[model samples]
Target: VAKPVFMSCNDRQHSLAFGLPGMVERLNHLHIQYTDFDDLGVSHDTIRSKDIDVAMQLGKHANDQLYTFYSASPSGWLMELGWGNYEKPAAQEHYTGDIFGHAVEASGYGLDLEL
Candidate 1:
């Protein structure tokens, strides 16, 4: 994901983490404050096997199409992660951050919620 993972305090202080696929596992193993939300249907058994701390069970949101859960971050804040049915922009990028086809400029501050 190109987006940065963040934890904010009082709407001011923030901590950012950018990681790859197994970043969640690394965060858990390190006991760092971080949250992991799954969209795209992660295997519950797989998550459990990793012994990740689960703060909430799988559920849907009131104004979202996400199938997600919450995890307690080491920083004492809830880290929200999830996937949704929002249509991907008609643009593609390679794993090396190379743009392919057309590029779409996506902008938002908080979660990009569509209702």
Candidate 2:
């Protein structure tokens, strides 16, 4: 099987949760889903088992139900899609800095990957 590049396991799962609406739109364009690991039940555990460089589990925390992107790497496209992996952009200065990738009562700011 071809291992995925340019995406983390969290990225995959988060994309599934957050990008559903946009994904559905894209689905119509291609018959086969580009969703690689889902059918094989290749979730977080499975992907991790494969020794793939998906994501590093620093620890666990909980959050409310919110969807946001993280700046996961030193690349441009994915960086543009997510928060930059180091510095918070001026536009996102309002982030509450919650460590858990969960939604809060006031905002939906999940996925607390450091840039």
Candidate 3:
């Protein structure tokens, strides 16, 4: 399994409600493929019922609390569908430096998660 990496806005509520869920819904409506593996035994019919494609099986990340699955987008990039309690204290900046020790390969370059 690949390590989980993603961008997060300081406002967790907006990110979770509008940012993530809205985007996922768009991808689904557009019939774009995405990665999701959080729910084990999630069948092909289930995916098609939502008008989405599954790119990875259900699994939990080792570095974070996100239980997620991966999906291949229409542009061929992977979109992660994750759910978890990842909110940190509002006073603190949520950043991790090299916690996974390597970047995830995407396209021809490495996707850096430390930014």
Candidate 4:
């Protein structure tokens, strides 16, 4: 079985949270071509044990400056991509959890990896 892969561009903003279908649509709209594992000789399985149903939401940390999303990696790791963080002057306060969103939906893995 092929592992779920989550891929996104570096130029993506924190506000954009496109799930698998939306991501593909956005890529097609931008005239960008992308190929997934199924396209690369991985057979499609209708019943995926790790199919992510819920899309990852844009989450703000308790500091409120950094926004990010956690997704599953093809290498069996949890990958995080973030944006809208303070660059010039670093944030003073440090927080542990998120202010809102960023909930892990995957049952066993603790991360959604469908995008």
Candidate 5:
């Protein structure tokens, strides 16, 4: 079984996102491989000691209230980790989509594999 380096349910308990260092360390420890890139799609090694970056970042959504991001796993699959999700059902009117955020920003490094 895979062990999570960090996880949380509510925004009050955890930060909106994980730091780069922690993500790198956890991915390395898990033997997962990923590639780092800038917004221009050029490879950028932000951390000199590590070779990984966030695959995608989907900001907090209005429906679930979850802030999530993705990282490329060794199997050529993206792994999503998120926090700040609603624990109890809050009474709210039905909505079709998120009010804001949750935009998709992919690294364009992974997502190519024969499955």
Candidate 6:
């Protein structure tokens, strides 16, 4: 199966909702397959717990370009952290970064959240 792309942030919040695909692609281009700097089953306060320099650098570049908080993208190794599958919660609020397919649109890449 093909791998799923996930966003990573230098900061603690993963819901920033911004430039992500480009960053991940950069990692892959460098032959770095491990996604890092993300907290899957671990505690939420461990940003410096692992080797995430590549991701950190990307975050710096991204932030420098957009001029906000850039350490928000995750490392290539982060993909291994695993953002477990969603089981369809009963009630929920639509968030900015939630995942949804744009089968209805030819251009695709629309951000959506489904409950």
Q: Can you tell me which runs of candidate 4 are displaced by over 4 Å?
A: 1-56, 87-93, 110-115
Poorest 10 consecutive residues by lDDT, candidate 3:
25-34
Ranking by TM-score: 4, 5, 3, 1, 2, 6
Off by over 4 Å in 3: 1-8, 11-45, 48-53, 87-115
**RMSDs, each prediction?**
14.9, 15.1, 9.5, 13.8, 11.2, 14.2
Residues 1-115, model 1: lDDT tens digits: 4334434342211324333233432331111221344322454445557775555555544332345544445553334345444332222521322112112122121222221
- Write one digit per residue (lDDT tens) for candidate 2, span 1-72: 222222224322223222222222221110112233343233334444765332223222222122222222
lDDT of each: 0.36, 0.27, 0.39, 0.39, 0.39, 0.25
Global fold similarity of model 5 (TM-score): 0.37
- For 1-115, candidate 6 gives per-residue lDDT tens digits of 2233434343222322332333323332111111333442232234336533222112111211111111223443222122332232233433332133212111111111121
Error of 5 at 12 (Å): 18
| Model 1 lDDT, full chain set | 0.36
Q: Write the per-residue lDDT of candidate 3 for residues 1-115, one digit (tens) a residue.
A: 2233233455332222211221332222111122444342354346547865454444554444445555455664444555555544454445343223223322221222223
TM-scores, each model vs. reference: 0.34, 0.24, 0.36, 0.38, 0.37, 0.20
Cα lDDT tens digits for candidate 5, 1-115: 2223434454323322222332433332111112222321222223213554455444554655655445555654445544453543345644455545534454443321111
lDDT of 5: 0.39
Model 3 RMSD vs true structure: 9.5
The runs of at least 3 residues in candidate 5 whose Cα sits more than 4 Å from the true structure, single-residue gaps closed, are 1-53, 88-96, 107-115
Q: How many pairs collide in each candidate, listed in order?
A: 1, 8, 9, 1, 0, 15
Off-target runs (Cα >4 Å) in candidate 6 are: 1-47, 53-86, 89-93, 97-115
Q: Tell me how far the alpha carbon of residue 47 in candidate 5 is from the true structure, in angstroms, after superposition.
A: 9.3
